[model samples]
Target: MTTSTTDSSTPAPGAAASTDERIAVVNPATGLQIGSAPVFDAAAVAELAARGRAAQPGWEAMGFDGRALVLRRMQQWMSDHADELLEILQAETGRVFEDSVLELAYPLTALGHWARNAEKYLRPQKAAASSPFVLSRRLRSYYRPYGLVGIIAPWNFPITIGFGDSIPALAAGNAVILKPSEITPLSIEVIRRGLEECGMPEGVFQIATGAGATGAAVVDVVDMVMFTGSTATGRKVGAQAAQRLIPASLELGGKDPMIVLADANLERAANLAVFGATVNSGQVCLSTERFYVEEAVYDEFVSRVVAKVSALRQGVPVAPGSVDVGAIITADQLEVIDAQVRDAVAKGARVLVGGQPVRGVTGRFYEPTVLVDVDHTMACMTDETFGPLLPIMKVADADEAVRLANDTRYGLAATIVTRDRARGAELAGRIDAGTVSVNDMLTHCFALGLPMGGVKTSGIGTRHGAAGIRKFCATKAVLVAPSFPNADIHFYPANEKVSPLLLAAVTGLYGTASRVARATPRALATARRLRRELGR
Candidate 1:
């Protein structure tokens, strides 16, 4: 996790062209460029993609065990250099040190999960046909690598989200080109260096840094694209991949909700709600944005939320005594947050806690806001407000809670806090989300064994677990017969005897069991006549 200052002339291994134009990677807290990233032109991206394609076969030849060894090396490298990586993450994203540290575990976890399971997941599996005719034939599906992959990552959690998809893609044996968010390319570069140090082949994993054009280039050139960002941008990415007719997996916007039942632990529920809403300053896709509390415990829940939020400390990303919140990413994002808050207040929503930007913070900082009396008409309740704003609305009962939770267009995740495990499980089945957490917020996401993805506008395809690795592969069915010399009864001739017998056999196999009993005798007699006529 070290930074290197490069001039326009000296291009890094897979960096963009040497244009005078550059993107400055700024530290949000200090409002200064920590490092400048190259703006890759179309040509540079093409060359990078070509290099990745050329290097893929050799890497693929490494096999699952070989790739797993490399992944383990990367994990050990990150562990050995955890402190330095944390410093770079904090400097680039302005996230609290604890939050950044928490994200670091995901990469190692993903790498380990894939390394441990890739062979089993991708191995050829028998898809035995149930029909009696094909019972003796061998039919299996083998997972084939997609050759090359392009990843467009968001800036929210640079280390985790930026390179998360790449781990499984590499494990599945495809070369990858990562187009990290221009704002936070530093951590990605740190990852690139670790891969290099682990003795991974050149061009197997590359980074192309720039804005939208760079990402577009990646989508255009690669065989597959995995994008993590806003829904609007994901649509554009999907369209681009559509032009090439290549596959894409998108992890997009989320307006996640939290449902509080009356029987739940009020204190635990409120504490988790505050953490879920404000974690990473609410930049996370799965961060709980809406709260639906049962009327019986609504007031108590709101009170607990205000108390917890009030005690949250905000400052530089990395400081002593555990900073709870960090600076917002940029000025434009801050403006969006402000506008949403203003709109909600104007529409009769009541702000229960801090609602404006923090009074004395030097950099991009917004106070953790809590809103009550919020209705669906308010933008803060419906749209994605990627700031530290928690909106609580009362529900008459569990029915209303579930209804309000599923009312959104996005269904990435939902949380239910309940003491009744059976009741919670039942309600979880009804919630139209990719993941429903019972008495928890984001624990499911970290559980790499379970697949994670979104429904509707949230995302396409899943990440982590076995599905994550398999998504990067194309399943090819392989079928084999005992012998090709022995021709079938339906080979070519339109014989009078075989035709009616074939129909009877079809009817017998597909129709009722009684029909099979009646048809079998005639079909066998026809087969004897046909065999004698064929000179056998």
Candidate 2:
């Protein structure tokens, strides 16, 4: 990882340019260098942010409809280039070709949704005045863009998180400077070109590739920051934004739980458990990490899960039909997974299926693992094992399941598997997570109208839905008063005549007595006298 500050000779990004320092983009599955990008330092990050700031005004001039048009064109471009994009996704992130489909589909859906609904969601909204005195004035709140927005996306689902976030920010009329994870920078470059091909203004969308330092530099310059990663990094980003008094939306880590009740469909629950825990090699933040099955059905459910786990195929993940699990992103991640599993075994947890890293495989690959008898004391149960490690524990009842599920600091998402859909939904409500699914695994995150985010350490703000676009904007209160010949009663210096009338008015409106009771003889007389004196 090489780093260089921006200078006069710094060529435009995405073009082949050799500098003193560059970051190599290696294929995680092959351990081969496929590409390289200039490692931008603080000065380069600042320069890109400055460019975005300068371009924001013209982009904002496009307004909601005009911006929506650009986003739709981007969606079309994505469709046109789908094959090439999917190939690049597999090359970099090592996700199975089927899972990589979402990298394009999700952003396209979000683009279409935001383009069609932005005006409705962001249009000035009328708000009622709290007091009678202001009833005659019209009150409305307008949502305006935050000028230049800085986005730091993760490698797990680069296109979706990167451009999914940018679509709404752009639709809301703000210029963006995105820094994709170094591991998956190429995918985002393709997205940038799509935006530019669709006639987005120069500098309106930018990508800076590097490591953590690059992201921190972006935060230092931009008006607002949107980050998706781990909780520890999210805290640092939040603190940096706080120091600058600029708001940052963080989508962080999760130890998502799946509650399997006695009434659950045994086969269906087992299938869901395997898919939920093993998808993307368990790299997803909302992936199910812990399973709490009712004691009565524990043995059967565990056996079914172990069977599914054993049947899963681990490979390079390039082929659509042959692979179910892909390579881990890095060797460091594999070591972390191994350490957690070792800790769990030492602490009395038993591996029911695959437990160790895959040997004689190309690149960083790990077996889809299933562990039984895992307890809270084990590291794999308590900490975020961001690999394909499924830990199952038995609970006496639903109450115990809920208690154990809520024990973790992360609350990004959870799932409830039961025969009674109503009961599943009710139990979902009881879980302390941002998104909850009933009789499902990850379906709750795909809808465009629903908000997605986490509570506690999971994240600070929401993404998607109307709230998604609004997150990139700030609300401004607008008040318009009707023209009148008479001045406002409370505007002038205190006068003997108006003082008593104003006192009586306050007493009549806000006093403890009923309106009729407050309208006593003295109050009525005072009102009449004021009306006459004021010529109302």
**Winning candidate number (TM-score):** 1
| Lowest summed lDDT window (length 10), candidate 2 | 1-10
Query: Model 1, range 1-536, lDDT digits (tens) per residue?
Result: 23333331124565545456788777786676677777777888898888888999999999999999999999999999998788888878888888887889889888888889999989999874655456458899899999999999998888798788899999999999888888788778878888989989988998888899989988888999999999999999999999899999999999999999999999999988999988888888899999999999999999999999999999785463568998898787888788888988999988888899866656788889999889899888888878899999999999999998999999899999999999999999999999999999887768888888999899899887778888898889888888865777577768988777888866655566676667768775654454444333
How good is model 1 by TM-score? 0.94
Off by more than 4 A, model 1: 1-11, 14-18, 318-320, 513-520, 524-536
Per-residue alpha-carbon lDDT of candidate 2 for residues 313-340, written as tens digits (9 for 90 to 100): 8887646787888889877789989999
RMSD of each: 3.8, 4.5
State each model's CA lDDT, in order.
0.85, 0.84
Give lDDT for model 1: 0.85
Q: In model 2, what lDDT does residue 203 have?
A: 89
